[model samples]
Target chain A: MSAPFTDAQLAAFLTGTLEDETLIDAIEAAINADPALATRAEALASAEPMDASVREAFAPVLDAPVPERLIAAATPRAAEVVDLAAARAAKSAAPLPTPANDTGRSSWRWPQFGAMAASLALGVLIGGPLLKGGGAGAPEGGSLVLASADLTAMLDSAPSGQKTDLAALGEGEVVLTFRNADGLLCRQFLIEGKGGTTSDALACAGGNGTGWQIEAYGRRAAPVGEMKLAGGDAAPAVVAAVDAMIDSDPLTGADEIAELGKK
Target chain B: MNPDDTTRQALIALIPRLRRFARVLTGSIADADDVVQAALEKAMVNLEQYQPGTRLDSWVFRIARNHWVDDRRRAHNRMGHDDIGEMLDLAGDDGVAVVEASAEARMVRAAVDSLPPEQRDVVALVMLEELTYREAADMLGLPIGTVMSRLSRAKAALAKRIAAEGTVQ
Candidate 1:
């Protein structure tokens, strides 16, 4: 027991990577065992807030236009869809849609070829699947990817419409789906552009097992399917994921989403 | 609406973040934007096999990484993939304003730019984007341990670079 935890583990803990309860507990134990480590953790936690100017500087990019070139490259699926301007306007005037609801999903249609291009774009935007040193290898200044197979396996782990929380590695696309116990269809997807960019979306509906596509892009992005889920079974992706991981019994209520996020 | 079209739009919406990530990886906002644009165009062409239930960000990032690597290969320079040798050359590049930076900020930015692409990506994903190691590692397709070590080394290198510049001042 080399003091229970190492500096590297502490750093990972600071970044919220130790999500498992046991790992967290172990980390806590380690910190408690070493006063210096605990102090260091505290200092890091309270470290100066993001330099006000730095945050302000980055804010523009966060709310900036999607770039005309990017807009032109994107194929809109619906005539009624909002453009980048409208999306930015909406984001400014309203609090971004909550994570708890199915508010983000919209609809669109485009040429068949556009779909393939969009899928690649989605892969870059969504980031690659989670794997150990396989898909993409971290280069001198960039990260590496795991093998393609591991990428595929990670893709298979999510429920319908559940976007894998991956970062853009190199370039790869992932399609994900799973039905919830209530029978609703859910799907989330991503495509990477040739320039190495990534994109994503989510959507869901009732337990009818019907397809509620959770993806759409015109000038602005939209999620697929119905706009809401009732009684805590909403976010078809979350519900579906819980359903797939269960050895027995379906998840219900808030617990379902909680468990799913944990995964 | 064609199902694929809908998917494209959703994915496109993620570009701003992707651009931000790219900037971190390439050390230049222009290069990052270009990389992201290229990645997006490529991803759209391969949507059919995309299975539902996968992490979208990671998938896209993988594409971006590939594009970046390809660019590196094309440039005929492959040294320092993980080692932080050169800081970002802030003095170069004619695109994107320096964001009201002080002289020291410019120096810091240059140092960041000089970092090898590997260290650069880890810093961008973990420090700049605030991604979890698991999330960052997943995006990069590396083991969590690899990510940890990379990040550890990156921080040390950044500190050294900053310290070195300070000595010059």
Candidate 2:
């Protein structure tokens, strides 16, 4: 009965910008009546999120090393210090690597800055099963090995300042506690694994409250004797991830105790 | 840090998004990088002109779009070809993983690439980059109503082309 909606009206309806409720009802009624209109509307709605796929296609570019040419171009230089030809020569001599390959699974191959390279390592090392490995009771494939369910229990229940000897599981302690942007409580721990390998990890409370999701992690050689430093000594990637995701600074000693008390 | 240093850092952070926008606009990675390089240079030289509180990404995006338009004009004059031919060339050369995507995905990409330059620009900013319509209008120096109309027409055209392909398959 109602006049068929125009393409613009249909588009507005799809984008949720069409505020006319009466018109929207009319359009819906029309669409229900007309199979062709329904098919077109469905196609448009499905195609709308194609941007997500586009973003995914380019996601690797975010982790790729920022090209030296762009970095140099962005760097501020005084007039007297400018040498345009030399910069051009350097750019041409060391061209940035291309992003594509035959199989199209582009590797992170560019010469990355120290911090970004460390972040790449952290992402590669901890991104898969380790992050999803849940808490101590999580299925086997997790990088962290617990001595007993007790250590897992302690990790789940330990307060920010609670320092327990995890030597039986792996020599380390739960060093810090804070909340992430999502307001989930998180713990940072340093552990010495087999072969004197030290790893630092940040784990946030999983949704069900029974486990944790490892948000960031890194591994390096352990110091000869001393326990690894907590804040400053953290891996660059780990520190950066924490700084980005943490809602605020690590809870103060009293605040941490109070937080633990509530749990 | 000085204002230049701060702006430079911000620009560095924005490079990935800018590159993505450029790829969509130019429809080729090589041309997209060239556009990005030129725009970054222009923005850096004129960093003092950039206001402190405004959205820096929008400003740079506008610069990139302007540079793209200029390059298109020059290419048109040099080759004695119309914009449609150039757009077709770009669609053919869209090297953003044609081999890896599904046939449907490639079809959608090609359909987008085949849009008119004005429509394609609007789609890239509003759809791909997820800019608000008002922001896109501001960046493109068009009225908001014009942007919505162009986007409406572009989406309809893309849907039609994709449907035709589906039917053929």
Question: Of the candidates shown, which would achieve the greatest TM-score relative to the real structure?
Answer: 2
lDDT (10s digit) by residue, model 1, range A1-263: 34556666676565444545566556656554555665555445422222232233343345555666555444442332223234434533433222332434321112221434434433432443321111111111101122233234334344433334343334322343434444443333343323333333333332232222223221112332232211111222222222232232333335445444433
- Residue pairs of candidate 2 with colliding backbone atoms: none
Weakest ten-residue segment in model 1 chain B by summed lDDT: B78-87
lDDT of 1 at A105: 35
Specify the CAPRI tier of model 2: incorrect
Chain A TM-score (model 1): 0.22
Indicate the residue-level lDDT of B16 in model 2.
75
List residue ranges in candidate 1 displaced over 4 A.
A1-60, A77-263, B1-3, B76-105, B163-169
Which lDDT tens digits does candidate 2 get at residues A1-263? 32466777777865545667676666666665665775566455534554564444444434445555556455554421233233223333432222322333333222332434433334334332232222111111122222234345656666654556554434556766788767777777765544445566766666454455555555543343453243434443344445446675567567876765453
Candidate 2 lDDT over B1-169, as tens digits, reads 8877888889988987887687778866556666777788668656777999998998899998898898787663222112322333344634545443434545666677678789888788878777766677678887554565566567667767867886332
